[model samples]
Target chain A: MDEVKIIEIKKSVFADNVKDADALRAELKEKKVFLLNLMSSPGSGKTTTLIQLINRIKDKTRISVMEADIDSDVDAVKIKESTGVSSIQLHTGGMCHLDAEMTRQGLDNLDLEETDLVILENVGNLVCPAEFDTGATCNAMILSVPEGDDKPLKYPLMFTVCDLVIINKMDVVPYFDFDLERCKKYIHLRNPQAQIIPISAKTGFGLDHLADWLLKQLP
Target chain B: MHELGIVFYIIRDVKKVAEENRVERVSEVVMDIGEVSTVVPHLLTHCWRWAADKEELLKGSELKCNIIPAVTWCDDCKQEYETVKHGKTCPHCHSENTWLLRGNEVEIRELVVSG
Candidate 1:
């Protein structure tokens, strides 16, 4: 019988990804490209909000967009047509999220030398995307009013990881039971330092604040 | 679906370890999965079967998960309690000032190989 040996190898599965993410961040810093990872649930108006914000900031800074989905070119086309910015679509091949390596591949396809900011719209998932770092300079997510204010409590990890939480659909606040103050409190419960910006993507309300926030994040 | 991505990471790490040690084939890979790590053990194994079989070193290898029970620590009471049962609140003192001490790990503990 062949001899059996048990090798001790205690390591977290996220360890390599973290290292990769750090390396990617360092490279992006050297290239002077600001990568922003935008996450949220499906139908949270991520595309609409991005279009509005990109259009607002495009004249000030050179911006590009990378849209990741299970399978689709609709978002990339929409972003390019609306904002007149270079956009690419990444297919995750049924994966729920894009990790550091996948994000690097997406970046490699773009002309980063001419780009000041790259907005990566991650796959619409509040769970898996929070687990993998995509080497972005900063992390942001959108929480719409219809999704309820209790989202921060339910998805604690998502709330904790995000640096900014854009509360969208504020125009419909009169019709819904969404409490802005309570929602801010819940978000702060998960992450105290997180900046919250309430916006109505449909009416383009408070988009200037979001655009200014993006501008300040540029390297 | 999330487990499948995890399986790919496991394969990459295991392959690197096997290469460094000059080991040709891995027989069993043991993991330390936490109760609240958000990874389903059975789903990990199910995904492992599909991904591991595709790798030469990991083919026919078994993936074993050792579940670590989640425990939460209370700041006010300074007591420990089962996290799954009490959640963010301390059951003993009923204080909401609590945090998880462990049970959020998703680690590769060991690898068994035939020499």
Candidate 2:
């Protein structure tokens, strides 16, 4: 029996992603631009929350947004048309998540040197987005009231990696069976350091707090 | 959902390694997929099959995924527990000082090649 040679090549599939993310983060830091990676499930009010937050702070801050979607450019159009901020749409060509290199490509063309903040509205996915660091200074996730409280339990990685958890659609919380305290407890369990903010993009409730937090993060 | 994109990454990385090692044809690419990791094993395999066949170096190459169970380390109890079962809080001591030790790997463990 001719023995086949088995060569060992231990390489991380995501190692290149980690390196690119670190480099982009260093570059962003050097340029004095704060990058925020915002992630959530589709219909989690990520766009609405971003629109409201953009309207609130785009005046005082030199900020722009990058909308990432699997196919559609509708979100990017909405951000530009409604908020009037410089926006770019990144179509993943069929991919659901945005990795570091994808984000870097978006930032490279968007002109972030003069911008104070660059928000990556990562592809609407709670599971895959958290897996790759998109070279953002802070990672934020939106969990709407209608989405129920068990999301943190089901998608622990998204909650765990997030620095801030925004509970959107607070106006509809009374209608839904979502227990706010219980949801907060679940988020805290996975991520004790995560700061949870209850907000309503429809009613314009916590956009001020979210905007203020964004300003504070600018270094 | 984006397993196809992940497939592209695997192909790119595998090709780079093969080129560096001066290998002509790659037979197999083994991956260490974590249980709780975002990349689904089956979907990744499907994507790899479709994409690898197109590449000259990776033609008919097999993509093997080894599942790794997620485990969390409890700081208070100094013990390891299953992450999927107990979630974040340590069931042994109910401590919040627990962190994930492993099972989040999305790396290529080894590559099988032939001259």
Candidate 3:
């Protein structure tokens, strides 16, 4: 039997994922747990920033982390050992971004109901993670001093999608030729409402302001 | 890249459709990608070539992408404008307070196969 046929159907595979993500967002909102999806390139101090944040806010707010990586539980193990925070490592296998399904699985694996604040550390890619919504209340993108200032313009999608832009590795800014003003201007051009905060996770500088911001967002 | 993952989704979805219709193989897949969706058509097609080559049902299948223009509505001027090229401040009133009308979409529109 020789047959040729065409089927026209407009369907979004991501539609189901988006629905699930919205449900997760509503659930988190009801629990008064503020969820933040942190995205950045590798070695941009995302883990370190989380470490500092966990250290500071551990006593204040019940903290938990869902670390997404392409293929590593090492970061999760380090986070667990250093901060003693309950963290679950999500291995995406080959997937670059963590979709809502993976996040739902992570939430199921970890006891999210007991936690007040949940931080989803997305895979070390700027582009894909920004497009995938993992049911977070807010999205935060970290740009370190060594990455330079032109990042916001070069990777406008990631910068524009984020609610907060954390300028990390401030301690090394003196050694690197990173222009702070240019970074701010670029980010503002992409998204005027983006909140900018500069900090050194190693030196524990500028963390208080971040902590305050997080606290204000909670409930 | 994420395009590889999206290609997987497309193939998987097409396979499901083929199975339901008792089709043996897929010949072509058409997708509508929004201009602002961040998924590059060239990258998607590249991934599609690699991914479809591995599957028997999708071998030598053609992947076609339609570019949908990014549009937004300016509340100040009550007019729609293109936002694909960036720096798209409203031409009428020069207001940046614009809501996106269309452009953030990525979906499978059609599938062709042999039954």
Candidate 4:
């Protein structure tokens, strides 16, 4: 009989995933497509904002969207109808966040060679989406005014991870008494480099600035 | 909430290592989780217990988590400081102009098995 030795292996499996994400990001950069992972809580107007951006920049750039949800292509359908751009729906089947693998798969489903902008509308949640890197060039977050000004402190990860923060639902600010200055201050406290954009997706207010910012990100 | 999906990654990695080393059963799995990684340790442990038990190699395995503190590098102060608790400002410069250096990671560090 031969004696066997069981040795423990110390390794990081996610290291490979990170490498893959990095490769995908390089490929996106080479293609000159600015990819943005848009994350926010449910009913924060991420879909509406996407629709507005699509309508605004449709003439200037070739836009494609990947919608990630627990279940439902409802938003994708709406985006397709409103924007008339190439869009795909990714059903995570209950996953709270969109991982790099899912984003890669979503990219495969679209023609990235021609896409000037690829926006990944991540699952409607503040926390998990911040943890998963989807190989996006930038992580954009939408924080509605109705969600309160303390959101940056309470959910610091979501706000801090974002390259840009859009304070949506400003049209309803008067009704909810949402302080725009306080929201900006809270976001700056977490991430000072984050660009804050206040807009109303309903009335298309302040969207021109958002459109210009999006265009500037493209190579 | 997505801890279950992460548990699958852990199990897959453990199984791959066990097979490569010709181990019959895995006894312990050690993981280093970052403080600001957005994964609740309790929820992850709960999900790991259920997910790992389903695999023969991981049955009865002890899952140990080492929590890493969040550290950030301040460009203005040119120093690194620990971000104690959540949403704590920089200690030295009191500057919010800081970037994360570490403690946002979630990875499997080591695994122990028996033949």
Candidate 5:
């Protein structure tokens, strides 16, 4: 009989990212630097909200922001010009999201040793960005009122995995048909431990509260 | 969005594995992709064809995807249902207390090489 050879190799292609993310988290813990992976849809006021946050924390601690986009450094320029903080623009070529390996590379490019907090403004999309962990200490997402109350149902995975959910554009809640309570109910269904905060980047309604809550999460 | 970049990542992994296994060529690479993982299988293969041919080891190799169905477990009913169909609610119980039990995976399940 002819010799038979069969090798059974059961492995995951995306496994490296998960392991890498965990290692990165442990390293961040050792350095006492908090890394936040902030995600949201375009026009959800991610940049605006980040600017507000930078102002609130810059005086007390050293903060750096990484603006990731398919192409363009417009947000990076805005961050540096407005907040005067060390900001870097990460161009993902044509990718919609930043995976763990990509996030690690971005961190290496930034000044990790000198900075206290590193917030990665992930590519502005709710679907792909939330699917992968960016090796952050925590992950957050912004759901604008105009995005509707049914979003939690549509994007259950995003809501389920996020540590914090910020409901932005709350100032226009009256004009829009968004039901905040109903939305929160749905979010809790997916993630019972998730913290939902209502805020408006335009009016600075809940920036302080968000800042206070953020500072508490840092190591 | 960058299925091409994803293909590059796959090639890199396959090369490393082949080097470790002391294999001259790879016949196929099988991937288990969940229905809701945000990875378009067709696009992945499309990019795979373009990049895989460039490498000597993967010149004529094949890339196959095994689709994994998405299921959500309803906490209220203590039952599981199709996630893509029923979404967030349990179909049998109509309860919103549900979470995804499966799907959303992009894993390399198997690698085929001749002895």
Candidate 6:
């Protein structure tokens, strides 16, 4: 009979990923590529907002889009057609979120030398994505008017991780009971430093501000 | 599910440790799961059974989860309280300036292996 030995090893599950994310950030800084991780729920207008923003800033900056999903190339194709930017689709192979390693693999597939800004449209999830850092320069999320103001409270980690929160679908805000002030308050409660931008990807309202915010982030 | 993703991470780490320690088989993997870590223990164990069996070193191993009670500290009151019950706001001070002191942990505590 073999004797049992208890091996002591106390380590966080996310520790390795955090190190990988930091290393990736350092590499991106050396390459002068700004990677933005954008997250939101399904149908939160992430694609529409990206298309509008890309078209506005594409000429000045060499932008690329990496669309990550459980299974789909719809977003990648749409971004290429609408914005005419270099776009790639990364299949997570049924995974709920992309980690730093996965993001690095996707980056390897891109023409990094030609790209200035790489926008990673993370999987349409607020939970798992918030847990894993995707090695992005900045983290952003969209909360449409229909999702209500209490989303920040419901998903505190998501709000806490994001540097920018875009309140999309503002053109239809009046139709819904979405109180902009209350929404801002809830977002601030979770992350006081989070910058909230109200925009309508449909009407192009306040998108300039969103574009400016992104451009300012880049070197 | 996210639990399955976490299971994969656990497997990777365990395999690395087994290789380093020259252990043939792991008997049990212990985890310290915080109450507010957002990981469902039952779901994690369920995922573990399915994924762990696929690996040779982790086959037939047991996963034991130690639930760590969540505690939050209020800067205003200089006191601590249960996080699950209070959640972000301090009950004693009624202050929203409180932050989690401990409880959001998903850690591999120790491994029981055959010597």
Q: Rate the local accuracy (lDDT) of all candidates.
A: 0.94, 0.88, 0.87, 0.85, 0.85, 0.94
Q: Write the per-residue lDDT of candidate 4 for residues A138-206, one digit (tens) a residue.
A: 999999988999999888878877999998998998889788898898888888899999999999999
| Model with the higher TM-score, candidate 4 or 6 | 6
Every candidate's DockQ is 0.79, 0.64, 0.65, 0.48, 0.46, 0.86
**Residue A106 of candidate 4: its Cα lDDT?**
90
* Weakest ten-residue segment in model 2 chain A by summed lDDT: A1-10
lDDT by residue (tens digit), candidate 3, A182-201: 89988987899999999999
Looking at model 2, give its docking quality level.
medium
Tens-digit per-residue lDDT, B25-53, candidate 2:
88889999888777799989998999999
Clashes of each: 0, 0, 0, 0, 1, 0
| Tens digits of per-residue lDDT for model 5, A1-219 | 323233355566666667888999899899988999999889998898999889988987889888899999999999999899989999988888898888888888877778889999999987877767788998999999999998888887789779999999999988999999999988997799999989988899999999999988877
Residue-level error in angstroms, candidate 4, position B53:
2.5
User: Could you list the chain B TM-scores for each candidate?
Assistant: 0.97, 0.95, 0.91, 0.90, 0.91, 0.98
- lDDT: the better of candidates 3 and 6: 6
Query: What lDDT would candidate 2 get against the real structure?
Result: 0.88
Model 5 compared with the native: what TM-score?
A: 0.90
**Error in Å for residue B41 of model 5:** 2.3
Candidate 6, lDDT over the whole model: 0.94
By TM-score rank, best first, the candidates go 6, 1, 2, 5, 4, 3
Model 5: which residue pairs collide?
A13-B108
**Candidate 4: TM of chain A?**
0.94
Candidate 4 chain A weakest lDDT stretch, 10 residues = A1-10
lDDT tens digits by residue: candidate 6, A131-208: 999899999999999999889989999999999999999999878989999999989988999999999999999999
What's the residue-level lDDT of A48 in candidate 4? 93
